[model samples]
Target: MVLLSLVASHSDIDLETVAKISADASQVASVVLASASPVAGAITLATCNRYEIYCEVPQSEDVPAARSEVITQIAASTGLSEETISTALISKTETDVIEHLFSVGAGLDSAVIGEREIAGQVRRALNEAQASGTATGSLVRLFQAASRTAKDVGSRTTLGSRGLSVVSVALELATDLSNDADWSTKDIVIFGTGAYAGATMALLRERGAHNVSVYSASGRADAFVASRGGTALDESTLEAALSHADIIIGCSGSDHRLMSSDITSLDRAERPLVAIDLALTHDFDPELGALAGVDLITLESVRMAAPEEQAQSLREARSIVLDAAETFATEQRERAADAAIVALRRHTQQVLESEVEKVRAQHGCTAAAEEVEFAMRRMMRQLLHVPTVRARELAAQGRAGEYIEALETLYGLAVDAPVAPSMKNAAGCPVTGTQSAAAHHDAPMQSPALRQVG
Candidate 1:
């Protein structure tokens, strides 16, 4: 199966479009699973700012046709027109796909470059695909390599050092706004109780904000607040909290706006209301920022204000990502070469065994015959060593497909190379060369614009 990728990320698309596409990750996964032919398997990774479908298609299928089908499915799920999706999507094949995955895992593709959350997201996508039995061996290996690369980058570089993330950036803005006043005296109200909410709560506490209230749009406020040591407010009290609060943090994960025209119009405190909306869908009405006593910081603004790494550091991190991707591709090629080497060895051993048995039958099973059998085995082993090593070397050198074809032609061995299969399918019958060999080099992917929220 050949690797293909379809991507819609914040870098190339607007937030509105991205939100629509990412509304349901599961539905996107379903579309990918159903539309592709002989889908060796597929993984759909949907996050706040990106929605990508990675598919493994049998080489026999029309690649362009399959890509069209997947784009059609995405349009169906996201209510987007096919023309729009076709125009907006970023497509990658073969090694380009590998490089993109590695970059994403390393957080080099994220809007907040070096953000650590994408590594977990990539892992979760792989896990979910595996659970559904859609992930094949190639994908498993690719994603594992990605995860390892990300961790390596984190350990080897300062990419993840210094509190970095949308949350941290928002908090920095909050602290800046609260500079004139003591953080301990401010009444902070946070919307939503998901991971973002928890993270915000923790950071707020670290800044000495003792008076905290949480509103759960999903009705988990009680549990969320209890765990985080904050008072849980119900919908009825939302307006009151909004009016009196010194600070408002939005991460409700709700599609509906938290601050409507009526809520923001209410009069009161002299201290300006500092609103930080970290959610992708935008938790508050953007118009609320126009009010006289409110300072609103949003994902876009935070992303704009995000710190940029020194050029040298960025170059180093990118070098790490590229190196990891090359290593993974080489490993996969080596693995693909293994099948032929194994088959050749097995055929040689069988021939030697048959010859040894014939000699024993002809001469009597004597000590001399045994010695002859041992000699024959040793000679065969020595004869096969050079070719076996060369085949592996060729595979590592990106000539795997050529060597495999040569082995098949020379030995008259019908080679069926296996695609990445779960352990259950590891011993699947040999496949012939009808399918095209894996590509040695992928097209260079265009450098996506500065990382966006995805």
Candidate 2:
């Protein structure tokens, strides 16, 4: 199956639009799979600043239709107009999809570059897809490769040396905004009990923040705090926690936004309160930033404030991602010739079996007959090995069509060649011709951009 990715991220759109689309990410895969589209499988990766759907379709030609189907499903699920959704997303197929996902998993595309949290998010996305039975083998391999690429980048480069992340940057901004720069002196309250919340908690502890309270709208706070070392707040105690909190971090992205009025109504201390909203769909309303005695830190603000990594480190990381993408694409291309190779081997095996059966019939399974059969089998293997190797070589060079044609012409072996996903340039021209691999390797990598769908 061909890989297609529909991406809406902080680079191409505002965070508000990203949040709106991400709100229904959990359901997008199921909706797409249940539809009449040619999509064989799908995996959704929804984060604070990005929402991506990776799909597996039957053929390269089905990509446009599959893209349309996914966009329609996303629009339907997210209550967005098709045109709006299409405008927000960039369509990626073949190697572009591979490179994009690798870059993302390695945090090259994050608002806070080189953040490690996205790697875990990428792994979890595949796991979630597998659990839902919506991830096909091709998509699974793609994601696994992404994970490996992420690890390679992390280990080989100093890109993440500071352990930077959205949460870490927000906390850094919070430290700057707080009256006391020391995290231990600040009374912190974290909203939501998911992965982001857990990450925030760990970072806070690293910064020596001990006076922390956890609150979850879905009653998960108790269990979350039990394992994570925080005081759990129920609905009745939430307002009091808010009032007492000197620093409030939101990771929940819950439907119930903490409005300015919610905090204003509370008899909060007149001291400075640094409110960090790390959620994509904000847990705190934007108006909260305007409140007296409060300073807001958001994903957008964090993006602006995030420190740039060393230029050499960034280049090293990107090179790793590019190399990984090329290797993955080459392997996938080689796999495209598998059907042809299998057909050739099957044809050879049939001939060998027929000749061996004649030997057995003529010699009544004698030792001489066995010797003849063994020699014939060895000769057949020796003959097939070169063609098998050539098939893979031809496929990787984007000449699988030629290999399949040769098989058909020589042996009357009408093998159904597997369709490899075709690469396209930003202008929508196919790049999978015989020179595609060489051209792609020589060309500089470009950022994924909007490819508007009709």
Candidate 3:
């Protein structure tokens, strides 16, 4: 079966709606399982930013047609325009499949640069696919190799060192407040445990601000309490702390301002209050800014702040990813060649026997008949030897996807070679794969963006 991958990322698609569309994990898994012909393996990797379907299918079925069916399901689930999904769906043939999977495992295709989270996500996804018994033989091996490479790359390098995702211009603007103004010995309290909050916390720490407390209405108190370095102060406690804090980082989801002085009973203090609201809605009470010694920073004002420059170290990390992508593509081509050569040898053997038998029948059973057959076999092997060698050698080259495709075509071996089954099929259905969803319970993914809340 050939590996097919569809990429849907960076388009102007509704992200939350896409998540909702992909929420029916069972249906998505079933479709993926059903799509792969001869049941090699199937997996659907999705997040708010991207959704992809990978499958092993026989060369016969129309690939684009199968992918379109998946697109319909995705659109139906998410309520997105079907045309958009169709337009965005991407497909790769032969070694491109392996290259894509490796790139994904390596986080080259991730929304966040050098995102460490994608590795665990991919591992869990492969584990599910394998458990469903849909993932068998070569598919299982390919995925394992990809996962191993990811682990190796991550462990060896400082690839995701920042861990801090550089988001929209808003958070960077908030960062400027620390540099533009000096708030030493200031109580910089974080309200809401969102991604923005975490960023503010890290920045606050960088600025030598002590008493950095994090408060959230929806956030877990236990997590906050154990946040050790970060105080897990609740909204009630947050308001009380606000009076004494020099910088108040607001990250709650309340429709109304939770920063009102009346709520906190802020006694007019000599210290200046810099309240940075990072929530979608205004979290801090507007009146709090009206109080003496208070400066309220809203999202609009945050957006107005200058953008942060890319760090040199992070840029270097990006180079590492690019190098890894090239290396992965090279490895894929070599393996594809190897598979093609195996297919070629089988086809050649069939042709050789047929031609030799025809010659023997036409010439009649004479001593010369056996000699002619031997010479014919030798000649055929010699004629085909160079092509076979070239096919394998070409496969080992770096970034040789196009070459691999050409070699497969030239050798008359279809790129989508059916993999032999190592284990018997558990499902009775005519499957390219088994129709099973990820049956195991994995911990729900916490929004990396949520870590930004303050």
State which candidate has the highest lDDT: 2
State how far residue 196 of model 1 sits from its true place (Å). 2.4
Per-residue C-alpha lDDT of model 1 across residues 290-359, encoded as one tens digit per residue: 8777788887777788888667767888899899888887776677677777767777877898999899
Where model 1 places Cα greater than 4 Å from the true spot, the runs are 60-62, 178-181, 265-271, 422-454
Better of 1 and 3 by lDDT: 1
Q: Which 10 consecutive residues of model 3 have the lowest summed lDDT?
A: 445-454
Give the best candidate by TM-score.
2
How high a TM-score does candidate 3 get? 0.50
lDDT of 2 by residue, 1-454 (tens): 6789999999998999999888776777877766677777788999989999998888889999999998888888888899988888999998999999999999999988899999999999988876665766688899999999999999999999889999988887877776466878778999999999999999999999889999898999989988989899988988888888898999999897899989888887686788999899999989988989889998999999988989999999999999999999999899888888877887778778988888899998789998898899899989988999999999899788899888767777776644333233355433323334455358664322212122
Q: Which ten contiguous residues of candidate 1 have the minimum total lDDT?
A: 431-440
Work out the TM-score per prediction. Answer: 0.85, 0.91, 0.50
What lDDT score is found at residue 321 in candidate 1?
88
Which residue pairs show backbone clashes in model 1?
A: 111-451, 111-452, 137-420, 416-431
Candidate 2 regions exceeding 4 Å error are 417-454
Candidate no. 2 TM-score: 0.91
lDDT value, residue 183 of candidate 2: 79
